[model samples]
Target: MASATLFHDVQQILTAEHPDPFRVLGMHTVSLGGELRLVVRTFQPGATAVSVTDEEGAEVAVMECGHEAGFFEAILPRGTSAFPYQLQVTWPEAGEPALMGDAFAFGPQIGEFDLYLMAEGTHLRLWDVLGAHPMTIDGVQGVHFGVWAPGARRVSVVGEFNLWDGRRHPMRLHPAQGVWEIFIPGVQDESLYRYEILPHQGSAFLKSDPLAFTAEVRPATASKVADLTKYEWNDAEWMRSRQEGDWCNRPMSIYEVHPGSWKRVPGEDDRPLTWREMAVDLVDYVADMGFTHVEFLPVMEHPYDPSWGYQVTGYFAPTSRFGGPDDFRYLVDALHQRGIGVILDWVPAHFPKDAFALRRFDGSALYEHADPRQGEHPEWGTLIFNFGRNEVRNFLISNALFWLDEYHADGLRVDAVASMLYLDYSRGPGQWVPNQYGGRENLEAVAFLQQLNTTVRDRHPGALMIAEESTAWPGVTQLAHLGGLGFHLKWNMGWMHDNLSFMSEQAIHRKYHFNLLTFSLMYAFSEKYVLPLSHDEVVHLKGSLMGKMPGDAWQKAANLRLMLGMMWGHPGKKLLFMGGEIGQWGEWNENRSLDWHLLADPLNAGVQRWMRDLNALYKREPAFWETDFSHEGFEWVDFRDVEQSVLSFVRRGGESGHELLFVCNFTPVPRYAYHVGAPSAGRWREVLNSDAEPYGGSNVGNGGVTETVPLAVHGREQALPLTLPPLGILILQRED
Candidate 1:
């Protein structure tokens, strides 16, 4: 070695240890014989000859091989100023010479302001600055790659273009912000890439980009460069109206669906439906059913199909199993055009411990906590996110906003929120650690949820933030500024559990468990609520909703109609799982399609017809949904009929003149001439009856109209004689 400094720099570049390769490997100025000269250095490890070509393709200097390891250099004359050049290299036994652009020729692409904001953890649009973004820089077109791996000794962009060689494109590190960025001249969309991170200790490993907009199909993990701006959206009207007001008082009947199993190709190996296919089929099917929205169980990318999208790997990219990222955008746009909103199931509670993903991301606990008590979820065999870390918080919050802003999602139903809120969740006394205040609540997670809700509402007003929180958390739907979690709606888990429990008993035994059906009203108005008969209820051998009813097949179908009617009549939004509408007998299995053949039978078809009518009636009549979150919207007419196993209630619409009365009989025995209180002395119309013949029920009900008499009953000045059908619910409205 002629110079010690040159020898050290060459070794570092060859060993892939140089944190910043631009200063040492690119063109530099040096002093020779008391005169300044231009020196060009290149590290083509396998090249036999290398030359520096000028801007006009003229050879300026033929580089001399300085080391047996393909280190080449050339120094120009003192009078020869620095000029734009390219590299022309010849490989041993190669047929022709190759010309290539120097990756280090470009300067830093990220702005300084973004770096500062990222360091402060306030960069809301961090996605724009990080990840693989294709752009043109200084008459050169390529991809700008950025990543956060503060703990790594060195990081390089490796892909098929670079022959998976780390020495080809070592990134420049921003030490203060812990970000590594570089402009790779000529990398474009559809290029598969991953980060080759050299940890400060141990062996190096490959990682898929955390902010990857799209990923290759599973069994082959690599990030694909996708241009999100190319897709043209057509949901202007929907977006404009969505931002105008809150959706609390609106009709929200959500049909929860798992896309992969919802529908499959007939006789074609059960192939899942593509996003484009779903757009054409699912959007219209849900529209025809009169559902206002469709809530998909986590559609984020995951390696295991059995996880049912719950264990997420690619948070930003929709699962490639359906289609490309643009395909997903098309699905959203199509649904929006049909006046149906989309709500995605978001899994921020925990993530699976996949080796190629976020686990030990930087050879350290970068995204999760170091201690098992704080980081690991024993029940799920997954890792819990470190909510207290600024970078981790930034990652999750940005992901939440990404779905809303980029994908045009109308709402987020955060899954397993109870797991995130409590430290002792599913754990024994000695196995968990409490917060600093010695409480069971995870304070950091609580703060993170508050921040997540606040940011989503402040930025995207009228967007819903729903929590699948099971416990009795205080004020889950209240505003954050008023000292609450700031969710727009919380799942009424208690109601679902109690209702199913009581409905499963025999008709004669239901009277003893009568309170199970009416106990939810005790605190129904405590938070904005959604009565969810979700996927969880039909899985894990819990049996289908129809199968849970204790009766013959005919009675079971009638009971399902009764349950659906009761859900709509209750003072809350409604969410029904996919197979529940058609009396599906089998429990939910994510591997296969729902039993679409069930609809061929009149018993099942009638249940489906009943569900469709329920949605139509629920949306049209404001009394069913207008004041769902307030105590004033509901009043108990009669709940003391324990021996008969019957109940009655009144629901009020926003208008003073709009009101409805509901009478329910839990048993399979008709009650004739049942007296129920009415609000006004007028004719009442029997608007909806679960015992109708069309809904797989025996025709047992009063005629369409009943006259109310001016007789005082149950604090109401009017009373009406009603015919309560067996295992049925009756909805009566005032005749105009």
Candidate 2:
């Protein structure tokens, strides 16, 4: 090649403007005087002199300064083949000359098949190839870094090893796949790093790795190099049982916990418990409370605490506020060992507008939409993901699987599914764009959700994909092939709203709102459901469950017990937020621990005891959940007694003949003789009564057992004359 052309190439390398750095910066073959010779080049900005050396530290040749900008090059002897080498550099201000392996010496770390899969947006384990991974390549140990930035002019791996200089280790770009990769030898685990991306038309900026397995703690956003393969998981039995168990029929009483405030160390500035601490404290509490699973608010990495983890920045990383990635794994393992499932809240609807994260990545709206109408979330002040884009879809779908695959999460409770389903969600007409068919439905998001559910179901059997959908969108819990979104379970927002509203009404006025209590059963079997009393109901001045009940102190306690009894007896799974079981008076505060002091109050202790007993009873009876989604499992004995503010129902255990009768009394007036239908002639034992003295009720109930009479009532062959408890529910089972 001509000398002038070589000088120009050297200038480009010195300035860090070379699109493909490997062609000029690493060892290569060149023709000189009709003979091919091996050449080595490097660009070290502050170095005074540079030399090439063999693997054994023997100097091959002293390099000449090809340019004044610290660009150095050397030609090896003729017939010298391309081989592994290191750069020995002497700095002007230094102590000893440093000898380090050339970051550009290694070949492509990502295989062609992986590249093809990435471009096609079908890479299920995208994190395996795209993030910083400590690996051995060609008998050398180094960290392989890869990122996707199609619009970037140049991308470099910048970190403490190279003094955070972008020019020192410019990555090799695979033009066809728009992926840049480099293997930096000696970059070990726990090293902090980030990407320096030079966009096509703007100044360069730094971004945390989207696929980072772990990140620096909050207030420090650098992504950390983690070795995720070292943890020895002991949940093999839990995993095997999970795959074989039928979750729909089995009991699932979830204790929803916000890790940040579930408990705090009063002696340590009230800081939240670490993952390891919670593994013992939180796991023991959930197990002793008889909850089947624990659902945590999003544990994914986020910068802002006020958002409560809804606005995610690092999808693949667990938040570092509590502990490291392995610490989180320890928490899950602990839960599994205690016979409890772990469900993580996943947010894919939108991400916060943090410049250091995914926003305007590559100086383009790459992860989100280019148009604000389609990209921005009006209510959240966040950016919605461009689900229509194949790469973006692949990002979110793979993230969902990442938690289940790496962290051993038994399920994911997808957040804000209602927002994803509608293009105009919280928008005022022109503020949003319509689909191609000119409708409000978000077609791309629907397709993405379907694909996400299908992939999770196919890859991990019995792993739940739950939807927090608040709309009447049909078939949310149906199979994907049957034209549904294919979620295993969906939160029943309507039931939660109606029942809470009813429970808040005064006893004298509850008759006017009787439909609110009975309305849920109308559509209870429409889809698989989880009746949730979540954090949403107890935050932002919405009031705690105890505060929402109408009446004086005693009446409030009675109403609270009645509400929980109804939820436990209802035809669905259950989820109750923290602080509810102990009957906290104030709303949930994210900044402080739950009101553990409330347990000292007898009324509050009664509520907690009632909740514990309710879960135990619910799980012990198949009639409560065995056929929850079918009409055959639930039978309303009577719904016409609105004047009395009372209702009766029967839960059946399919053909097993296991049945339980539920009679609810909303008014504070107890009835001495109330007749309820019985499925057969037998001694009906009062198994559980929310108004018992132990639960702070008046203890007004039948005397343990009531034998069925010969007289008919409510279209049944026999009837049971019973004493009804005021503002309480009684669960009775046949003893004959």
Candidate 3:
């Protein structure tokens, strides 16, 4: 299959890396045929996929790439871009496609060189921030509106702007380059507009610059209007939750929740919660659960229909999904009441259709950028704010602070940190640009993130800032002073990835990869981390955590126990999505609420009980908390005959704290008197058991045996013999 709609004459973002044969990234011209039709694409390589969108004021186009399109062959034609959209190659057997840095787009253009690697940069200035209106006091006219398309034949800046007609709106076209540029000196405060690209150079289509700061609807769509702003938040002075000391990267038994679907009782009228109503109910639940914190998917104002709340239309307003802006404030306050911090999943990475929001809140390049080459997120058609512009920087920075300070959120889990770091984060080479200074171009985004962390921390000491970074962009979770991104905590994505991979494999093969269980301990070397069973795993393609396991009900139970045991014992913060505790049976649907009824059954109920006990044990045991123990606490006692499916480890508390040893049998048969190495010689007590019949596990073992059992070993102190059951976790404590 080939790309039916082809692109031509593509160009690249100029940089100093290569003076000649400049690599081509994107094109300067996009041809959206008459009726201003929308173009879309979906990048689905699995049963489920990540489909990007496009939104510019009144004009919009969204299309999903089908899973049937074959792995890389499924380009849903996202939206028209100004560059040569690279061809995505698919590999079904590999599970996913590799980033083949090749240039492919809508037009006939070739990249002159490799670009994603070249480090190009520039000094950040004031114009990049959002909501920044130029001060024309006394006559110093700063940056103004422009009717420009350097790559087009003719253009005009139109909106609730300089009149509807093309009157004072004519943009000048540089014939030599077949483009246009016109600046309106007097335009500044309170404005919204978009560039209308004319059919130039043998083209018969109208285009919307993906980088337009303000967009307007030109008919033939469900929405078309210039957006302005009107919002009033009273929580600006709220102090964020603690970030350091007692609260710094502690056990994060996060109750991952999607506000829209958390309590939605299937047929009920969409789980309605009045601000005060939810506050009263939810705060009680968090405190009772023993979880340290709670994470809410993008709570900032967004279009309500979106299930995951990923498509944000209002960056500053809290979603009216459940209630109003102040209602969200009440929700945060409720969390604080329970001694639990709330984490807001921020979407600074993109925005949806809310012309009344960011669509050119001011004049040209007010909230975004003037050129698609700089302001567009190619994959997610949403208008990507120009992180390089001063005003745009301020807009995003201030937006971040607004949630932290006003809403009193303890922290923010910045979405898509990978996108913010790389110039061509997901693009094939030539699609990105750097400043005049020569660096990996999105330098402004990085700097702003640093500033955001620093500022948030300075304002509130214990303010925890976490990063959802998938890419190993060195120092992403490091402190700003160390020249890193300054996030207090980062998602241990490697663990999630490897663990999921291991869980998906048959138990017979899992033993061979025992290293995956303990290797992520390496994450402790950099910034603090949080092991999150995020919504990503269970909802779509990857399948629910339980569904990924390979075995019968009993084996599945054991598998879960093993995974949960490792998660709890691991050295890092911890979190769990809403229904994961009760063993949700269905896939995570963005539309429906969590399947709360699953808890009604004895089997699922058992999983929930085990989770509670784990949390209790984690808190009661000092080995689970405190930083000094990281280096000395966790050690794999045995992985011998990993192929047979057996693994064991002992976690010793630091500063002379209590010690606990955990052993597991991944195989299907029971093993008697398993030899596990222990650090001290003394009585060992069976403190916890995952084989409890209540949790859907067989009662194949004895627990609470408070008796002395010691063995001598040459290394440190000794090893001990303990009974083991297949697919079960046994916790023994040293009893002197």
* The best candidate in terms of TM-score: 2
> Over all chains combined, what TM-score does candidate 3 have?
0.67
Tens-digit per-residue lDDT, 1-736, candidate 3:
1334221211101111111111122122233443332233322223233322222122122223322432122223445443222233344466762322121122211111211111121112111211222333223332233222334434555545334433223344333322233334444543455544433244212333322222222221111221122234333333422543556525567888876666654456665455566687667766776777789888654544543767665555565456655567777876775677788898777665354345443323445666666667788776676776543555566667667655677778888888777776667657667665766647777888888788777766776788998867788767798898888888888989887787767877787787787677666656577888899888657677777778976566577777887778777778888877777767788777677777777777888788878888887787776552256666767766576677776776666576787777777677777666676777778777888777777777756663434555324456666667777788888776
Q: Per-residue lDDT for 512 in model 3? A: 71
**Ranking, TM-score, top scorer first:** 2, 1, 3
Model 2 CA deviation exceeding 4 Å by range = none
Query: Whose lDDT is greatest here?
Result: 2
lDDT of 2 by residue, 1-736 (tens): 2588777787778778888889888898888888888888888888999999988888999998877678888998767887888889999989888887888788887899998888777899999989899988776777999999989999999998888998888999999988899999889898999999999997889999999998999889999999899999999999999999779989999999999999999999999999999999999999999999999999999999988899899999999999999999999999999999999999999999999899988889999998999999989899999998888988888899899999999999999999999999999968989999999999999999999999999999989999999999999999889999999999999999999999999999988988888888889989999999999999999999999999988889999999999898889999999999999999998999999998888899899999999999988999988998888998999888889988999999975779999999999999778999898898999999999999888899987999999878999989999899999899999996
Looking at model 3, residue 152 earns an lDDT score of 44
Residue 374 in candidate 2 has what lDDT? 93
> Distance (Å) between predicted and true CA of 29, model 1?
2.7
Off by over 4 Å in 1: 54-58, 77-80, 91-94
- Give the per-residue lDDT digits (tens) of candidate 1, residues 1-736: 3789878888898888986788877688888778888888888889999999876668889999987787788897558887777788898888787877677767788889998888776778778988899887767678989998899889999998888888888899999888999888778798999999999899889999989998999868899999888888999999999998668989999999999999999889999899999999999999999999999999888989889899998888899999999999999999999999999999998998998888888789988988988889999999999999887888888999999999999999999999999999988878888999999999999999999999999899989999999998898999899989999999999999998998889989988997898899998999999999999999999999989988899999988888888888999999999999889999999989899999999899999999999899888988888888888889999998989988999999876447989999989999998888897888999998989989888989998789988778888888998889999999999888
The local lDDT score (0 to 100) that residue 671 gets in candidate 1 is 98
